[model samples]
Target: KFEQANGGTILLDEISEMDQGLQAKLLRVLQEQQVERVGGRKIINLDVRILATTNRKLEEYVAENKFREDLYYRLNVFPLQWLPLRERIADIVPLAQRLLAKYSRKMNRTAVSMSDEAQRVLQAHPWPGNVRELDNIIQRSLILQQGALIGPGDLHIQPGSMHTAEMAGRINSVGVSQADNSQLGNDMKQHEFQLIVDTLRETGGSRKDAADKLGISPRTLRYKLAKMREAGIDLDAELKG
Candidate 1:
């Protein structure tokens, strides 16, 4: 792949899936910017850019000794963590429209637009399967669609599916009181917000440690903090109190 993409970019998709042996070779190639062609040792010296993606946590994999620590550091030059679709509610309609156009072109259909109600429906769903789920649903809607607008009926999704009680976690570990727990029972969002606050305080405001305790990425924790602030939760005040 490096030889094929000489002077260009090559993506190592799901890099964590590469075993130790392959990881060693890849690390050498990335470090030297060169490769030896199989069955022909001409010592191909090439310039290439490397990009990688993975769903699993590579840091955890390194700690578990499943992934090469050196390779993890080499590929950790730039990391980007994208929030799940449900968290990116504002992007739903635009992404759907883009996908609709893409699939329409492939299907040889005229331009199609989602109805206002249909847009609302897409945004309302939890989207547990994320963008791939959205992609499949849009394709199905395109096929079942009538006229040029994909209406509410054209779309299909199981209601109340894959949502684990608004992703509620064990609040007992946070050390909240019985009275606060009673109020938390009434409001799930507030419960989650308070949980994060308590965890941060327990970690002495170390976001990384708090994220590790909460079993979420630090970037996700940052997003939650942003949401809490947007909801008018005074983080400083909460931390002090």
Candidate 2:
């Protein structure tokens, strides 16, 4: 398959989570530009460009012997670090607008725009989950929005209670009622839990399908469900329905 991708790019996302044996195999492939398939003797040449991404610090993994040092060096030839959304405040509105357009089209919803108040709320967000979180929020907001404009009320941005003091001040400046913000924060988790349950139902209890519809990985969905179970949420009963 790597050989078939000759003259193209192959992205290995979350490379740090890959198995150590697989890392050694990949290192060999990179060094030799060829791969031997399982149960096959012929070596197939590959001329594919490899791009890998990981949120973890590879150097730390190397120190812990969880990641191969040679593989890390090979993948780090041209490293690019993207700042979290909270730090790139200037990009928030533009990214939000782009995402809104994208997901609206995807969901067959009206081409909607964000209200000034909603934009302010987004800019004030701590964005602990970064771009992916923002994307999910936008998609959810689109589903909840009734009009052509998405208001702050439509957003289900979770972990809202963890907002910075500056963000709280900004929310206040936007004339968002404290009661409303507090209620939203309180309802956020239940809303997310319900969303997951509904997606699972829609996908007939298939975790992979539900994750695909929710724009998240099955591993992420499993981890979230595990946390919910740890918190005493009755997932088994909810999922059975």
The alpha-carbon RMSD values of the candidates against the true structure, listed in the order shown, are: 18.0, 13.2
The TM-score between candidate 1 and the true structure equals 0.62
The digit string of per-residue lDDT tens for model 1 on 21-120 reads 9999998987887889788878999888788988899999999999999889999988999999999999999999998998777656686888999999
| Ten-residue region with minimum lDDT total, candidate 2 | 168-177
Residue-wise C-alpha lDDT for candidate 2, range 109-137, written one tens digit per residue: 66589999999999998887778777767
lDDT of 1 at 145: 48
Which parts of model 1 have CA positions greater than 4 angstroms off? 162-241
For model 2, the superposed segments whose C-alpha errors exceed 4 Å read 37-42, 158-241
lDDT of 2 at 177: 19
Query: Please, what is the TM-score per model?
Result: 0.62, 0.65
